[model samples]
Target: MGTLLSGRARAHPRELARFVRLFTVVRREIEYALRPTGDLLHRLALETEFSDFAFLQTVDTRFRQGEPLSDAWDAAVLALQTEKLLKTEEIALIQAFCSAFGSTDPAGQSANCAYFIDRLSELQKGAAEAAGKKSRLYLALGVLGGVFAVLILL
Candidate 1:
């Protein structure tokens, strides 16, 4: 009986649509967050809190048009520090960027990344839990209706 009801519940069009929408939103957000070479330099300049890097200044020059800062400084710091062959001045610039924009040094960026990732994971988990609950509710409703029909016939 449970298996039969589960099959019927899975066939519901509305539940399928909701699942698809949830998946699409999660995919888009994750892709945006993980993209390589996102507009970090542009963001740093506009935010103006961490525009000390000379390379960032050059990157700023290419953008003749107005653009909003979307990338966080913490992300940029992590990217720079991850590079193995960076010069002392380059490292210094990364530190400066972190200082201007981030709450802490390189460690702060790591912590921030961890925090954000954890939040994303939590959101995904919550969505899955909600979907499971909805599925269970639908299954229960179908099963109860079936039982009620049998009782009425008897």
Candidate 2:
């Protein structure tokens, strides 16, 4: 819904926030349950409807393989790099979100997730504004180009 309308691979603020909230909740659950990282990831995997389910699976596999959390996070972000549906800013935000899950400390991870949530909210507003203006400009340019070409042919 967001990428198509925005004419780029940008996530809607609301959609971005929804994932941020999921991360926050997961962070809290980790802190309270004192669970192993892989166990948590497996749990998340079972809840596979998230847009980033594949990413979560990657993280889970990385954890199971004894890879560093940061490494796992990087792998997930790397997968996102080639997606045409994501703008550079959206990728940057995703990188930031992944970084939060890298923290070994639950409190620290939760804090980072919260901070990025606020940042993404602001970005969403800016994306909406840019999309409206850019769409109009593109439309006007297209019409003008079409009319000029017809006149030249006449």
Candidate 3:
């Protein structure tokens, strides 16, 4: 009976590991799907604008019905869908990952998901800062050139 109980306990961990694996794949898919691209950002902005409109509509409805909070779920879902658009190749990659390791533990999966999300956010922030610096440098150079030209004329 002790041996049987030990086997059962081991099985639980194994099962949990499998669920975690599934969660990891799903999280990775979500990240890849939401990766920023020039075209993707443009589309996302449009979708965000639409989402705002939908949110307003929901809020208006809620106000009329004397509800405190709006029915914002639909708008949020729409926005999420828009931002999480996946390309064919990304979708295939995610599907393959899921097929191979779909049984990961939930706790492990959540940890992995959070790690990836944080990493992605950090990368995005770095990229944005770099872009902002470049823009500022270019603007300063343009202003200096304009001043130089005026001095030469004078």
Candidate 4:
């Protein structure tokens, strides 16, 4: 059970790392290139190597279908949540980001992305540490269990 939880915990950091990278890209595109979000999303959908790249495509499609950008983003995040890809706190953070995104000037947009990137990075680090601790704890428990079984058998 601990091993299972450790594995699940490991995935949290990986997903957060992907989001950190994604938002970093957003910040760069908005701050340096001054590109509109639609183009950026389309490009990211095509170019991102992450397993969750489909969410970007989904957001792009939803946005093109006359939905608000935030709504489209929410739909995509909902998909992630449905897949158990994000925890509750992560989802809330993403929802907050969705609300703030594209609701301001280019500078503010860039700043928002940057801020989220930092936040996601911090979460990723914490998740990684948790996973490591869980892994070690589980390994120790498993060894102890095996020793107990061996003694009982003897």
Candidate 5:
């Protein structure tokens, strides 16, 4: 179980990086595509390498309903749960980034987007580093533990 979670933990940062890309895209598009958010969402959905494409469509619908972008993202947290690759901190960062669109000023929103992108990027980098260092260690430990257990039983 520890090994499984360790692997997933490493992978989770990449998932966070996906969200970072999404946030950066929105930041870049803020001037031309901020409003009529469905259009923005569609564009981002197509352009992004993110696998959770449905979440963007759902966010579009929420935007159409005039929900705040933050709330829309909050609504989509359920979708994140489905990915199974995200940690709670990652989810919280995404939730916090959802507010980037709350500002009417494109520059301000873009700044917010940049902040999220940077933060998520840093987080993903940290996770990737930990994964590279720890995954092998944990796998070895698990094998040794199993060997010890078998020897004790014998």
Candidate 6:
């Protein structure tokens, strides 16, 4: 899942927006009709069109197989980290989310999800800005290098 998204993100900077949308949907779904975490994950696994569908499915499966939600979420996040798909800030946000998730009442869990979603959205914006700046910097460097080469030739 992260594999596919990482590659796609390289080609389309808006890929992280998909992740934002995913979290928003999760928040909305849970808030609409609170259910058990495992059941919520199972439903998201079936309904989500995001690249993290596999991650959600794996967590749901592991939870059903007797793993704790935090443990399953940790394992899944670790797998995503190994793929290098997440930034350091994003990783910290996700870890915080896992720690708080399932340890609270349904309302609290929903609020936790909302908090993380907002944090993730902010990180996404920063990343997009950084990517844009780096692209412009690289473009300027390329142009400068071309001009220098032409001057040297003359």
lDDT of each: 0.44, 0.65, 0.41, 0.81, 0.73, 0.70
Top candidate (TM-score): 4
In TM-score terms, candidate 1 sits at: 0.29
lDDT of 1: 0.44
Output the lDDT of residue 54, model 1.
36
Candidate 4 lDDT tens digits, 78-142? 89889786778887787788787777999899889988888888888988898888788887887
1-154: candidate 2 lDDT, tens digit per residue: 2224445423444445455566666767766786766676667766745535666777777867898776877887687675444467876887776655645577776677677767766776776676667666666776777788899999
Runs in model 3 deviating more than 4 A are 1-108, 151-154
- The predictions' CA RMSDs to the true structure, in order, are 16.9, 4.6, 21.6, 2.5, 3.6, 5.2
Q: Please report, as a residue range, the 10-residue window in candidate 5 with the lowest summed lDDT.
A: 45-54
RMSD of 2: 4.6
Q: What C-alpha lDDT, on a 0 to 100 scale, does residue 70 get in candidate 4?
A: 83
| Residue 30 local lDDT, model 4 | 83
Query: How many backbone collisions does model 1 have?
Result: 0
How should the candidates be ordered by TM-score, best one leading?
Answer: 4, 6, 5, 2, 3, 1
CA shift of 116, model 5, Å: 1.2
**Per-prediction backbone clash count:** 0, 3, 10, 0, 0, 0
TM-score, cand. 5: 0.70
Q: Which parts of model 2 are misplaced by more than 4 Å?
A: 1-18, 96-104, 132-154
Per-residue lDDT over 13-112 for candidate 6, one digit per residue giving the tens place of the 0 to 100 score: 3545655676687677777877766777777777747535555666777888999888888887787677675676677776777787667876787788
lDDT of 5 by residue, 1-154 (tens): 5598567657766676667778777776786666654567756666546445666767767877998766777788878877767778777877776554654578788788788888889888898888877777777878888899999999
lDDT of 1 by residue, 28-130 (tens): 4334553222344345455543355433554354433443222343343344556433434434433453243333443444454454444434444554566
Winning candidate number (lDDT): 4
Candidate 6 deviant stretches above 4 angstroms = 1-18, 136-154
RMSD of 5: 3.6
